[model samples]
Target: MPEPYEERTGRRQTGPFAGQTKSPTDRDGRAVTFEAGAKQPGYVPPLSDHLSPNQAHLGSTSAASQPSAEDYLQMGIDKHEKSQGDEELSESAHYFRKAAEGGSAAGCVFYGLALRHGWGVQRDEKQAFGWLEMGCATVMQKPSTDIVDLDRRQSLMPMGTQNKLSAEVIMAIYEVGNCFEHAWGVPGTKRNQPNHQMAAMYYRLGAEQGDRDNQEHLANLLSQGKYGLKKDMWEAAFWYRAAIDNGLSPIGLSWVYKVRLLANQIRAGWP
Candidate 1:
């Protein structure tokens, strides 16, 4: 300390405990600062460890045609049937049971579903899982291969089209389609089933959410006075306008060319 401060510049030091200067430099004499919280380039953190904005929105996607669980299981059954068309009941039971045991509630439901339809064997609800319901809930709950396929197909979405939509919206649109088309598993009862009234309700819900398909179905139903709904041309035209807003170019043409032409011909012939 009694000498000048320049005397401490070039002193050679040895051993682990020999360093005494406040400045710590590397061999290149460059001072480096090590930060603990810094992130490296292209680091994708785990889902549980760090959820990004994109990862957080995984469950929110709107689907136009959400296939039911029964639909899925029936597809598998169809494949099996096409492969082994001449197989006996006992032989086919193995295929259905295999699908059932592998967590496809649809598979379980369809074992009963096939029995109900007497596809491969005698109709026996007693022989199947009577309580296992598929489609509406199971399709939404499980991690299905069908859903995974849909995910892969939708991976390359344009940036402007990706929006966070709720599962309820998807289910509602699916219900609307089933009601309009009289799809399988939609209740066939006169009071509660896919009648015009039910179709109208589902269509309104889906249309309010900006689905043009629903708008078109609703318009068609209104135009024809089907499903016990009153005939109202003005109301029908309003729904067509909504469909037009949602990119219904072909739908617009069909309404103009086919339906209107048929209606005009029918009116001309009405004596």
Candidate 2:
């Protein structure tokens, strides 16, 4: 958690990311190199399905034998894109479900998306939450850095042999957090109540991975002292800057830094 070189050189590292700035360290003290993946392929694909939103999560196990979860996910993505009718969208969701059950974190995310949005599947948030959590947990067990460049980066040690983690994989994690953060905002059942702790945990996961949106949300929590996170202006500023580095506009980071400076000058005892 050393100060980012961005605070030193006063410039964003827009060139070769290797050796140009401080690499985050792994839990084992190994320096963590960034390797980010972007938006999931065929995300929010054309929607129309014959299945009722009440469909059950079954039969995916009986799917026509596939090689691996990646293949299932690819099939789902491709099918969704090529879906010619309602029944086809259901076919896409079926493949996504197959991939999810096959243990592809990305597959879990896509399946969850299908469930939540009623895209050729049951619009069931409860089921969606479960699948999404499964996907995020997979990533949690095997985290990756989130810094994109002209090309996809690599984390040879941590990621092991999994398919390259993508924003889609991380989306599963982030969406779970989103469910918790805005729960009560909708004024509905108990499910709507915001679970700050859950939100904070997932947000921090995505943020640490260098996801732009998650960094800002985690920073917002720190600044507001919500989500069981203690108020720490410095940490808030850090994440704000991280968000900007990942693609968020600099205006928000600038404001936070300015606020941190003012707080310090006023001797408000803020971190």
Candidate 3:
């Protein structure tokens, strides 16, 4: 019902990042260094939002070495964080694009966001939604183990990779639901505008994965019977309770209690 983001506010939504690192290389192409816990001039947002601590470890890059998918993603983070102006930000987006092309799910998510907000790039809501969806569209499969190989190695996934896969999926899912709920980047015209049905579907997917914000969103929708759902106050209470336990906003404590009470009373004589 409301105008899309680019249409609503005159400007774009801005926010992205999680980490600190030595500049990697200086003018002479020598390694640069930073003091631990010291905030350098022109500090920027961190990679915390998109990456777990394990995944956010500082990475090094040099002109001579080829960058991997992860490297591209990290380079983008560094650029985005330390960017002095649109030029650097644009460079950051370029790296994110390369990361995505090189098969980084987190890369897809960040690049999608950049497109969505016109961060360092031109705004294109449709493409933003596409990249976001692609980030979560497929389950990251372990490379098939050769039947000839013997051992537990086949089933084991690196913790960092696992964490990256999980966090990125949840991030992409939440963003998708948020887009649907707000009509930010969903496809189509009238058929695509702020559809609560689609939003609820995506929220439930993340809520079931223990995403606090998703749980809250789903709970609100259930409580109000939005999206063609029958008002199920008990279910609403259930999700709100889950959200509370999961933390994040720590929202709806009192409201959840009242809703549970109201649900108990309403259902008491029904069955």
Give the top-scoring candidate (lDDT): 3
Q: Model 3, 57: alpha-carbon shift in Å?
A: 6.7
Give the C-alpha miss distance for residue 85 in model 1, angstroms: 9.3
Q: Rank the candidates by TM-score, best first.
A: 3, 2, 1
Taking the tens digit of each residue's C-alpha lDDT, what string does model 1 give over 1-271?
0111123323221111112233322211123233587432212112111112222332222342753433443444444334323243334444455555554443554454444334354544334323132322332332122324534543222335445433333333333243233422343233233355545654654455566656766676667675455666656767777776666555334444455566768889953
What digit string (tens of lDDT, one per residue) describes model 3 on residues 113-132? 77876667887788998888
* Candidate 2 vs. true structure, TM-score: 0.58
Stretches of model 1 off by over 4 angstroms after superposition:
1-172, 175-177, 180-194, 250-271
Better of 1 and 3 by lDDT: 3
**Arranged by lDDT, best first:** 3, 2, 1
Return the clash pairs for model 3, or none: 17-46, 17-47, 18-46, 18-47, 18-48, 19-47
Model 3 lDDT, residue 135, Cα: 77
TM-score of each: 0.34, 0.58, 0.65
For model 2, give the RMSD to the true fold. 16.5
State each model's CA lDDT, in order: 0.41, 0.57, 0.63
Scored by TM-score, the top model is 3
Worst 10 residues of 3 by lDDT: 20-29
